[model samples]
Target: MFAKLPFRTGTTSSAIWQGFAGSVMLLLGSLGVGWLASSSVLIRTPLFILARTTPAAVICATVLLCLGALLMFRAWLRLSQHLSGWNDDAGPVLRKALILWVAPMMLTLPLFSRDAYAYIGQGRLMQQDLDPYTNGISALNNYFLLGPDTLWTEAPTPYGPLWLWLEHLAVLIPANSPEIALIPFRLASLAGVVLLAIYVPKLAARHGFNPHRALWLAVLNPVTLMNFIASVHNDSLMMGLVVAGLYYASTKRAVVGILFVTASIAIKPITLIALPFVGLLWAGSRAGWVRKFALWAATLGISMAVMGAMGAVNGLGFGWLAALQTPGTIWHWYAPVGIGSVSLGSLVDWLGGDGTPIADGIQKVAQVISILIVMALAFVKIRLGPSGGLGADLPEPQRYSHAVMRRMAWAFTAVVLLAPMIQPWYVVWLLAFFATTGIKDGWPLRTVFYLSAFFILIALTDQLSVFPWISMEVVRSIAVVVAVMGLLYLTLWDKKTSELFKRNKPDQHAFAVKS
Candidate 1:
């Protein structure tokens, strides 16, 4: 069925076949990973009886699983390349491919994060009339039934009121069956990805980019599939709403756009950064400075009112405001500011100074610097001009849309890089924006792709635990071998071989011409 779809000029029959084969391999790998690994919160399904138990079987499954993942990654790169432009026929094809790719994962256990279990627990808290923002999952006596990871057992929910209310609804359905309760949450995440698939292309086309390529980057990318869909992260819903809001705001429906963006903020407050950009998008070149100011003010006012109404409906009030700072307490190496703080602390200690205070000071400095940089960029984007100036000849709405997307991309990057606790999925915020605006074939684009692969490995390693017989040494060895082999195959054997043939073609052409 996929073979019949209309792709761009360069798409080959071989590429389609290859991608189908890779999807099959990814399905098997997902099954292996799901079967072998135990969930921290949920009970094992009856299907887990088929999981590899012996040393040899486990090792073989591990290798196969890694190979399948790499294969899936390669296939996506090929298929995305075939997606050259906004072909109307490509939409159904992309959706079909997405389903083929994601179907196997749905049958398997959650792939990367255990946040869904936490959501279940938080929802139970809300159902019990306990404010999730102020109370942790520990507040619920039957928290064990939900199987949330201990990391968040004592931590109050940092998510916004809209999410809390959604959690309430999720927990209320199929109340007796603990195992079945999680299906709703996963479906909700799936709904979010569906929204993204629809809006990303629309936004891309409006801003004069290849909507097909944008769909590939925003939806088919491993980061989106693994973190957003498989892991069922709330960021999926937030991003979906964000993209939809941006699309509406760009199309001159400023009121509708503000409401959507506000809803996203109600899911996760970090998206509040986009509110100002939306206001600016509504204030285009045609509007005078005074009108721009008034529009901005009106946008803020309406957004706040809508949010307040949502808060009242949920009965959660504004507790999420205090909860916003909750995530910053956790630190990780992936965060630039986090690692910097640790490195600075060690340096100060080595130099016979107080390390704790110095580390704190360094973190604050990094954060302040990032904020200032974002502010400067926003000011320049608003006062001066758009970054690429590609939309100068376009309509005012399209031009302003491109400008706001570009600036928002920068701001989102700053937020991710500077945050004390960074997750693999948070990068999607910047990626969704960039994919629509158009990524240049440069270092930044390359870096994003590289990071996607790197984070996949990191997430898999963290989530997929081997049996006791496998030994930590054997597991580490397998990981190292797989990483090296995958890197070599992808970079040298696959990509380099293509480059070599292309380079040699020119010489052959020159020789033929002379002859």
Candidate 2:
């Protein structure tokens, strides 16, 4: 099946196959190094027990995982280089790659995150007729013994009703057993991946971008595979819906597009940022404030109706609105606001004052600032003279659609960067739109490529379950050394991949879409 897909002129069948092999390795290694919570049923399996009990097995598996991640990253870079322009075959090539890479991941225990387990626990809560918004997973018997993170024990679910309803159904299918429930959960996540594969190319082609490059950047990237496939995050489904919705809107089916975006919001409310852009898409390029305002009202009204209907099911209502505050509790250092909050709070503590309130205040202010920035980007038009910047050369008809997508991408980027916490996978929200709008070669393309590689490494090393007896520093050092070795080989030793680091004249028509 992999070989059947047409490859671009310069890309080799052998090179792409390396990524498929790497994914298989990743799955094998994950049996030892992946998240194996104490309550997980898999812990009783012989392979898992042997790997966890023996330090040597753990070390070997970690090395294997890191090596696999490096191989996949290198392959993706090589693939990116050959994507010079639009190829009708790009979609098939990327779709095949997606399947080959994602197949092995489906067999692994949840990698990089225990969120899938939390989904199962939340699903069980639904099975018991509990309102996940008001009650935490802790309401279940022996909830602490389950595989979900302790944070979810008391933290109400932040997911929307559609997601909760799906979770409820998933758990019920397995009689509330977390182990069996994971199968359905993963299958549900895979459905999202399928949506992405189908829509990303269509969206790219609709906007005159290279469908192949867009699909590669958004779908085949390692960060996307690990998060959406291995980690089983609901964000996958949310993003797929966003892309599908945007594609429909770009094609002039505004009402249908608005409905799709609303369904996306039902999966995760974060995509609510996209509603205004959908309104703009509906209002058309020459629409005045009155027309745009009316369309925006219509968009919101339709979205509210859809979301309200979903909320009404099983009496879930709109509690997810308030529960939206749940994820704000986490303050990852990667986020700008998170780091600023911590730095400012530390300074206050140095002066012998309570810094908790001050830190919280910073997050709130940053959140508000981010919202303002997104709104400004979405509404305020900046003139770039005759050549309208990124989408300036596009056909007049497509110019509006292109601009809206570009702004939507930036809007998602702002929200992720300025949010109280930024997860590695959150980047996918912006990536889908940016890829479709067109990422010009040179720094624009290189930046996205490098970031994808960096995130793959982060995902590889960040989530391993270290045993109590093992020195965490030692394990981290080993993983870093192995991963660095792999990087060295790709950047310095491999002929094809080495070209990525060399400075070259920028391609003037890199972003040009074939009409």
RMSD of 1: 5.8
Q: 273 in model 2: Cα distance from truth in Å?
A: 0.4
- Could you give candidate 1's per-residue lDDT for residues 353-450 as a string of tens digits? 88988777777777787778676655554543655467554566676777778888888888788877788888777889888887754454556667
Cα error, candidate 1, residue 78 (Å): 1.1
- Candidate 1 Cα lDDT to native: 0.70
Would you list the clashing residue pairs of candidate 1?
none
Q: Candidate 2's C-alpha lDDT?
A: 0.80
**Per-residue lDDT of model 2, residues 352-379, tens digit only:** 9989899999999888988998899878
Task: Name the runs in model 1 displaced over 4 angstroms.
Answer: 1-46, 49-61, 83-89, 142-145, 175-179, 349-354, 380-389, 442-444, 465-473, 495-515
Looking at candidate 1, the ten consecutive residues that score lowest on lDDT are 506-515
